[model samples]
Target chain A: MHTTDTETFEEQFAIEQRLVDSVVASFDSTTDPRLKELMQSLTRHLHAFIREVRLSEDEWSNAIAFLTAVGNITDDRRQEFILLSDVLGVSMQTIAVSNPAYEDATESTVFGPFFVEDAPEVTLGGDIAGGATGQPCWIEGTVTDTAGNPVPEARIEVWQNDEDGFYDVQYSDGRVSGRAHLFSDAHGRYRFWGMTPVPYPIPSDGPVGKMLAATNRSPMRVAHLHFMVTADGLRTLVTHIFVAGDPQLERGDSVFGVKDSLIKDFVEQPPGTPTPDGRHIGDRNWARCEFDIVLAPEQI
Target chain B: MHTTDTETFEEQFAIEQRLVDSVVASFDSTTDPRLKELMQSLTRHLHAFIREVRLSEDEWSNAIAFLTAVGNITDDRRQEFILLSDVLGVSMQTIAVSNPAYEDATESTVFGPFFVEDAPEVTLGGDIAGGATGQPCWIEGTVTDTAGNPVPEARIEVWQNDEDGFYDVQYSDGRVSGRAHLFSDAHGRYRFWGMTPVPYPIPSDGPVGKMLAATNRSPMRVAHLHFMVTADGLRTLVTHIFVAGDPQLERGDSVFGVKDSLIKDFVEQPPGTPTPDGRHIGDRNWARCEFDIVLAPEQI
Candidate 1:
C-alpha cells in the first residue's frame, strides 16, 4: 500500500480503526476481567457497526437525542430504557444468551421488570387475581424435575396484566393485584385463579414507540402470563405461557419473545360455565390454561 | 449437530441465534432504505455483542440503570449522553468515520456540543474574550484552499472554555465570552485576541463519572481551543488546536479527540513585549499561536 498519512480515504480510515484498538486497550486496567471483556467487546462491535454503516453525523446526533428523550420520560412509574431494550430485541437476546437451555428446564424468557419481591402468598387453587379487572381464568400446572420426578413445595410466583393490558403495579393507587406466589403440592400439582393473559403494547408512549413507528414495526405483544418457579436442587425458571391462535404471533411480538414451545391453548369458557372448583360466577366468559414446568438440576 | 430441541446448551444457543435473524428480517418492511439498513445492521451488531459477551442478567439490569441515571441528570444545560459518548470514544469514532481526512484540510475532531449559532461577529484583530476571565493570548490563522489559493472572507467561528473551564452556555448567569465568529480579510488572514486554552474535567456527578471511576480512567480533557471554519465552495472544518505539551495527552483525553497533527505550540510572551496589533496591556503574560487552515472543495 503506497500511501501518505491520509492520501486516500482508506489510509485515513485505517488510522480511525487503530483508535478502536486504543479504546479497547484502555480497559486493560480494569480489575475485573469480565468488565474488561465486556467493555472491549462492546467497543469492537460498536465500532464495527459504525464503520459498516459509515453512520452519518446527523444519524449519530439523532441517536443521542433519542436516548436522551428515553431517559427524560423514564421515572419510578415507567422505565423507558427497558421498553427501549425490549423494542430493540436486546432484552430477549440477553434472555436467550444468559439462560442456556438445560435438560428440559422450562425455557426462560424476559423476567420483565414487573416482578415484586413481596407479592402476597396465596394457597394452591386460590384466587391470585386480587381484584384486578379481567376475565376470570383457571390456571393449573405441575412442577417436576427433568427426570419427571415431582418437585413438591416448589415456590411459584405468577404475575400478569388485566384485560386492560396494564399490570397492577402500573397503577398509582397503591393497589396490588393480578400477582402472587404459591407453592406446589406434594404431587407437584398447583392451580390458581387469575385473569387471562391479554396482548398489550409494552409502554409505547416513549421514545421506543417513536422508533417502532419510524421503522414501521408494530408495538403489540401477544398475550402471555409471567411465571417464576423455584425449587430446592433445581435451577430457578422464569418463563411465560403465551396464548395460542393470537394473530400477533404470525406478525411478530414486539419483544421477539414468543416461541413455539411456550405457546399453549388458552381454552375459553362461555358465560355461566362451571368453574373448576365450582365457584359461582354470573354470566361472564373465562379461560383456562395448563403449563407443566420442567426444571434442570442446579449447576452448583 | 445431531440433537433434539433444547437438548444441549449449544443446540439451544442455535435457536437463540435465529432470533437475531428474525429481528434483522423484521426491518424488511421499513420503507426507507437507509433507515432499514441502519436498523438491521444495528440489530445484528447488538445481538452479536450480547452473544459474544454472554452478558449476565444482573449486568444488563445495571446497564439499564446506568443509562437511566445518565439521562435523568441531563438537562438543557448538561448533556450526559454526549459525555458518555465522549468517554466511550464513540464521538471521536463517529467523527473519524464521517469526516474522511481530505487534503491538508484541518482534520475534524469532535464537534463538541458547545457551538452556538448567532455568535456576535467581530472585526479582524479585535478582542473575542468578552467578559471572560483568562490570560490574554493572540491567535492568527490563514484560510486557503487545497490548491493553495486564499479563501478570502472565509467564516471563522471559535469557542472555548474560559480560565474557569466553563463555556458561556454552561452558565445561566447571562454572560458570553471566549466565543465569537469573524471573517478572514481580503488576504485570507485572520487574527484575534482570546484566552489561552485550559484543560478541564468534563461534567461529572453523574453515571458517566461513576463509570469512569469504576474503570480507573480520568475524566480530564487536555487543554485546547475549539475552531469551526467555513467558506463557500469548500468543506467546512471543525477542529481543535491542542496544547502541544499538555500532560493529559500522555495519559488520555476522555474524548480521544487529540491527534498528533492537530497539536500546536502556544508560545508564552512577556507582558511588555510588543503587541501584534499595537494593543496596550498591563503587567500580564500572553501566549500566541498560528493555524493555517486548508479547505477541501465542497463535494456538492
Candidate 2:
C-alpha cells in the first residue's frame, strides 16, 4: 500500500486517547461498587474538564499552585481546606447524601471546623458560662428513650456562645472562657446556666472569608448551643440545638443547621424559683428552657 | 438558659457541628460549582482516605513531600507531573474517553512526553535520515480529501528515531536534526528517507520511568514516525505513523501509541534499485512503504 500524504485529525486525537488508557490502567481493582463507580466517574470528569477547558501551559501551572496553597493552609487546629469544603456545601451534601438521617435520628449537620479536645468537665446543674456574654440563664434537658422514659446516667455534653457569641476555644486561653462539658444525672436530667444567646460574625480574616468577600456574602451565624448525647447501647448523637427567637435563627444559621424540631423558645421567668441546686435568685427576670433528646439504636 | 453543668462525647460532636456551620457560612454565592464540588469531594475523600488508611503523621508528611517534589521537578521544557499522568494512565484514559477522532478521522495515540516546534522547512522528497539507527528506508505518503481528491501544498512535518532508538532532536543542538517541515507538491505527494523502524525505550530516568519500575513495567515503544500536518482548509493533525512488525504492537505500545490502521510494513528492495529521489542504494538493502492521510474540515 502506498503511504498517504496526510493523516486525519482523528490521528491527532489519539494522543489524548492514549493518555486516558494509561490513567485507567493505574487504578487498583476494587470490589466496592460505589468506590469503583466513583473512581471511574472522577477520572472521566477530570479528563473531560481538562479537555473542555483545553487546559494550557500556564493554566495548568496555576491549578497546581492553587492545590499547593490548599495543602499549605492545613494544620493541626486549622484545616482551611476542610473548612473550605464545609463552606462550599460539599461536606453537608456528602454526609446528607451518603447517610440520610431522616430515619428517626436527628439530622446531622456539618461538624464545624473548630474543636479542642479535653474541655474541662463539669457536673449536672453546674454553671459553665464564664462571665462574658450577659445576664445568666438556666438551661435544662433530659436524655430519654423515644417513649420518654429517662435513661439513667446518660452522658450529655453541651457548649454554647458566651454573651459576645464566642466559644472559649476561639481565643488563645483565659480571654473568652465559655466552653463547658456536662453529663446527665441518675434521672437523665441535666441543667446549667450561661449568658443569653447572641449573634456573632464568623471569622473573616482567613481565605474562607476572602472567598465570601469576593462574592459579596456575609459570614454571620445564628445563636445556638452545641450538644452531644450518648448512652449504653444507644447511638451517639451530634447536634446543634438552636435558640428559636435569636435574630439569626432563620436566615443566618450557617450550614443550614436549623431544624424545627431542635429549636426551643427561651421563656423569661421570675428570678427565684425553688432551685434544684439550692441557689435562690431574687425574683429577677431570667431565662428558662427544657427539652429532651431521644436516643437511636447504635449501628455498631 | 443556664450553661450546661456536664459534658459528654455527644456534646463534643455538637461543638464540631457548630464549627462546621461557622466555616461553611463563609462561602459566597459566586464560587464555581465545579470547584465547589471538587473541594467538597476532596474533603470527604481525603478525610475518609485518612481514616481508612490510618495515615500517620510521618506518612502524611512524606506524601506531602512527594507532591512537593513533583511540583519542584516541573519547568518549561518538561513536566514530570504530566509524565505522572502518562504512567498513571490518566493521560491515556483522558485522551481515549474524550477522543476527538470518532468524527471520521484517523485513530489517535498519545502525544508522547516529548514533542517540539520549530521544524525547518524542506521541500517534498527531502530526506530526513541523519541519525544512525536502522537500515536505510524511503517513506512516502499522500494527503487527500474524503472523496479521494488530492490536497495540494499541505505541510507535513516529520520526525523519528535513528536505528538505535534515539531521536535526532535528543542529540545535537539540544534540538534534533531529522525533523523538518515539507510542503506537498501538486500531486499531494510527500516523501522522506530515514532509517528502518526499530523499537526504542521511553526515557526511564524520569519520575515516570521510576513509577513504571515500581510497577514492574517496561517502557519500549514500536518504531514509528511522528508528523504534524496542516493546511488552510483543514483542522491541524498531529499523529504518528507506525512501522508494522517492530515488535511490541499487540501487547500494546509501552507509551500506548499503537493504532491498527497506522501501522505499515517496510518492503525490502534490492540494494541497487533506484530510490524515490532517483538515487541508487549503495551496497545495503533498502526499504519502501506508502500511506495516506485524511484530514478533517477546518475548525472555525
Candidate 3:
C-alpha cells in the first residue's frame, strides 16, 4: 500500500464492508438454520441498501420516527404496517411467491389487515350484508377444481367496505356487517347478497397516508370485493374481483391487487327486476357480478 | 412469454421483478428528488430481499406484527425501533457512513437513545453524579484539533448508566444524574466526577428481546461512557470509551459498538487515594480514566 493521505472511495467503502462482514459473521452462532439464513441475508441486504443511499443520520431518524407513528396508530381495527407493505407492493409480491400460477387458478392478492377471524355465516343465496349501508348487490360464483370438478363444501369468505368507504370495523360502535363466510353447496355454486364495492381510500389518517401524500400518490384502491376460498386438499385462494372499468383501476389500485383476469363486469339492472332467488327488491337498483373460482392442487 | 405451463423459477422471478419495477416507477411522480431516490432504492432492495428468500406470507405478517410491537412500546422514554436498528448494526453503519475516517482523529459511535438535551451544567471538576449511586470516579480529558492545538471552550456532553445499569431517565422518579455538560478550560483540559461506567443490557422485554433470544445473541453491552464534544469549526464527536478488559467486550458489544482504539484503562484506586481534584473520599474505592479526544475538521 502506498503511503498516501487520501482515502479513496474504494478504501472508505472497504471499511464499511468489513463492519458488514462482522455483523454477518456474528450471526454464525445462530442455532436455527432458517433463522440464520434469514438474519444473515436480511443484514446483508439492509446494509447494502444503506450503503447505496449513504443514508444520512437525519434520514434514518426520520424513518424510525415514521415507523413509530405507524405503530402507535395501529390497533385491532387499524394496521398501518400492512398498509405500508401494501403500497410498496410487498404484500402482493409475497402472495405471488407463495401462490404460483397453476393451471388457470384464480390469482391471489393481499388479505388486507381488516379480516376478523370469525365472520358471520350465511346460508346459500342468503343476504350477507348484515347492517352496512349500500346498494344491495348479488354475488354468485362456483368453486371448482382446475379439472372443472365441483369443490362442494368449499368455504368462501367475502368482505368489502360500505358505500362510505369504511369497513364495519372502522366504526367505533360495535357492528359486524358487509362480511360473511359461506360454504359451497353440493353443486359447487355459491351466492350472497352484499353491497356493490365502491372505490375507497385505504386508511389515510395515518403515516402511510402521509407517505403517499409526500410522494404525490393517491390512497384510493380500485373498487373490488375481497375473497378467500378454501377447500380440503386444495390451495386456498385469496383474491379480489375488481369492478370493470373503474376509474381507480385506470389509475391503478393503490395496493397493486389488480390483475386483468380478475376484473369482472358488474352488470347494472333496473329496479324491480326479477330476483335470481325470488328475494324481493322493490324500487331499488341492484348490481350483479359472477366470479368463478378455480382451485389448484395443494403444494404449489 | 412462450407457452410453458411449467413456470420455471426464472420466469416466476421475472414476474416478481416486474412488480418491483412497477413499484419503483410509481414514485416517478414524486416531487422531491431525494425522496424519490430514497423510496425507489428502498423498494428495490426490499423486494430483492423478499424475492431472494421467497419470504412466506406468514413471515411477512410476523415481521409486521413485530414492527408494530416495536412501535407500540416506543414512547418518549423507550425507543424500541432504535434498539432494533442498533442491534442489527444499522445505526453503527450509518455513523460510519456519515463520518469518514480522518487524520488519526477520535472515532465516533452511536448517539444512543439515552442522551438528554440541556443536561445540568457542571463547573470544571464539579461532580456530575448527582443523586446517582455509584463509586466516585474521576474523568479527565483534553480536547484538541488534529494539528495538536488546544481547543478551549469546547462543549463536552457526557452521560452513562449507573452501577445499577439504568440511566436516570429509566427511573420513574424525576432525577438527573451521571450526566452533565462543561466547557474545556483555557488549557483544553476538563475533569468531572461521575460513576465508573459498567456493563448493562438493553431493554429486552419486547419483540427485540425475543429476537435476540431466538438468535442466541447476548443482550449485554460492554462497559463504556458516552461523550459528545463539539466546538466551532470541528466535527461533533459522538463516541464512547470502553472500560478496558470488560468481559462483554470479549463477548462483543450487543450494539457492535466496541472499537479496539476506544478501550481505555479505567484504573481502580484503593480507599484514601486522592482524586485528581483532591476531593475528600471516606473509605470507598474509585476509578479514573483519561480520554484525550482529537477532533477532525467540521467539513469531513
Candidate 4:
C-alpha cells in the first residue's frame, strides 16, 4: 500500500547538497561575522572530509571514540588536542598563516605548552640554572630592528628544558630553574647562563601518543630554546632556536618547530675558559650560543 | 653572531608541506589499508583546512575547548558528538554515501541516539502503543525486493517519539511506549496500531544545543517514524518516513534526515469508519499511513 517511488543517486546527492546549504544558511543570523565565517567554513570542510573518505558508520564511531579519548586525556599538565594538532602540522601551519612573512623578523613556531608567566628576571650574564642538573652553557643575543638598528631595552623571555629533557615545571620538587626573563642593555645586548639543550620525547602516555604509535611516528622534538622578544615600536616575536647539529633536526621535529634559519651552532668550550663578563668559567666544560633577534615594525 | 637568514613565505609553506608529507608517510606501516588511507587522507584534509582557514591560536584553543565540552557532556543517555555531526550535515552525508541508491528501495537517514536493543515484539495487526497516551493511529507496510517481489516474513523495527515529543526512554516514569518490533506476514505485510508522530526538538540542553543557539539554528525535527527492515537476501534498510506536508519538512530538519520520497500522507480518518482488519469503529478519530520498503540485494 506504500508508495513505490525511490530516489536515484543524483536525487540523494541533491538532498545532501540541500542539507549543506541549510546548515550554511543557519549561520546567517550569527551576530559575529568572524564566527559565522568560521562556522560556515568548518561545516563545509568537515562535510567534504566525510564525503571524500566515504566514511562508514564504524569509521565514524571510531573517530568519535578517538576524539573522546583525546578530550578525556587532556588536563592541566597535558594538552592532547594541541599535540594532535601539532602532529598533524596544523599548529605550525596556523603559526605560518597568522604571522605571515616579515622581513628580518624572527620566525615564530608553536608557543608550546610549557611557558610560565612572569619567570624570575635575571641580570646581565646571570645564571638561570638554579639547582638544575645539566652542562653549563652561556647564551647571548642582541635585539635589532628590521632596518638593522639596535633596539635598546627590549624585554626578552627565555625558557627551555634542561639536559634531562624536562621543563622546570615538570619536576615535582617545587623548584624553578631553566627559565628566566632578561632585558637587552643600551647596546641591544643580553646574556644569561643556562643548560645545554637536549632533545626530548613529547609526553607519550595519552591518546595522542597512542595515535602516534599506531601511525609509526616518533614523538621527539629537536633540542631548542624558546624566546619571546618585545619592544615598544616593534611587533612581538615568539620563536625557538634549534641546535644546528641536532640529529632530530634532520629527522624532522615532532612538533614541526624546526626552521633552517633558526638553527644555531652551540659551540663547545673546555673547562677554565674566560667568560664574557671577565670571570673564569668553572671546572666543568661548557657550551655557548649567540642568537640575534630582529623584530618587524608594528603597524599603526 | 647568529645567522641573519630569514625564510620567505614560500619556504615556510614548503616546510609545512614536507611536514604534512612526513605525517602522511607515518601511516605507511599501518597494517590495515583502510586505516592507513583514512589517516593519510585525514592528515591531508586537516592540513588543508587549517591553511585555508588561517586558523589563529585563540580559534584553535576555542575548538579544543568546544570538542572537550562535547565529549564531557556525552554519556549513556546522550551522544553529543553525533548531534554535532547531525547539525553539521555530516551524518546525512555519511548515510548517503553508505547507502547507494537502488531501484524502488527506500531512502535511508540517520540512526539517531534513541535506539534500544531488544524492543518488545508485536504480532501482525497488533497494538504497539503499550500503556502510552497519544492520538490513535494505524501503520501498515510491505517489504519487497527492488523488483517488486514480496519478501515474506521480513523483520521491521519501529521507533518514534510520542505527541509530547519524548521517546519512551526519555521518560523517567519507566513507561514503555512509542517503539516496538514487528514482522511481516507470509505475504510480506505488517500492521501495527501506534500513535501519531509529532515534531520534536532534539535534546538541546547540551553543547550541541548551545552550538545551535550560537549559530541561530533551530533544533526541531519534522514528525516521522523510524523503520529498519531486514530480509535474508536483501540489504538492511534504516530510514524514516516523514509526515507529508509537515511544516518542518520544508523548513529543514535539525538532523537533516528528511527525504522527498520518504515523506507520506498520514490520512486522517473520522470516527465510525471501519478498520482495515474489520475492527469496530471507535469514538476517537485515528490516522493511517502505509510505508512500503524495497530493499536492495545484499552483496556476498
TM-score for the A-chain in each candidate structure: 0.93, 0.77, 0.96, 0.92
Worst 10 residues of 3 chain B by lDDT: B1-10
Residue B244, candidate 1: alpha-carbon lDDT: 85
- Tell me how each candidate scores on DockQ against the true complex: 0.57, 0.09, 0.64, 0.37
Off by over 4 Å in 4: A1-19, A29-31, A115-133, A149-159, A162-189, A230-233, A271-285, B1-31, B116-136, B149-157, B162-188, B192-194, B230-233, B269-286
Task: Tell me the fnat of candidate 1.
Answer: 0.71
Error of 4 at A237 (Å): 2.9
Better of 2 and 4 by DockQ: 4
What is model 1's interface RMSD? 2.5
The regions of model 3 sitting more than 4 angstroms off are A1-6, B1-7
CA lDDT of B294 in candidate 4?
Answer: 85
Cα lDDT tens digits for candidate 1, B163-213: 998899888886777899999999899999988899988876789888777
Which residue segments of model 2 deviate by more than 4 Å? A1-28, A31-38, A41-64, A98-104, A130-135, A163-165, A173-176, A250-252, A268-286, B1-300
The CAPRI category of model 4 is: acceptable
Error of 4 at A255 (Å): 2.7
Clashing pairs in 4: none
lDDT for each candidate structure: 0.86, 0.62, 0.89, 0.81
Q: iRMSD per model?
A: 2.5, 9.0, 2.3, 3.6
lDDT of 4 by residue, B1-300 (tens): 232345455665776687688777767787778878888888888777777777877788788778878877776556788788888877888887778676667888988877777889998888777876777788887888888888888988888888788888778777778788988988888898887788999989888898889878889998988888888978888899899978888787888788789999899899887888776646978889988888899871
TM-score: which candidate is best? 3
Per-residue alpha-carbon lDDT of model 1 for A99-152, expressed as tens digits? 776656788887775778889999988998898888888999899998899999
- The true-versus-predicted C-alpha distance at residue B194 of model 3, in Å, is 1.5
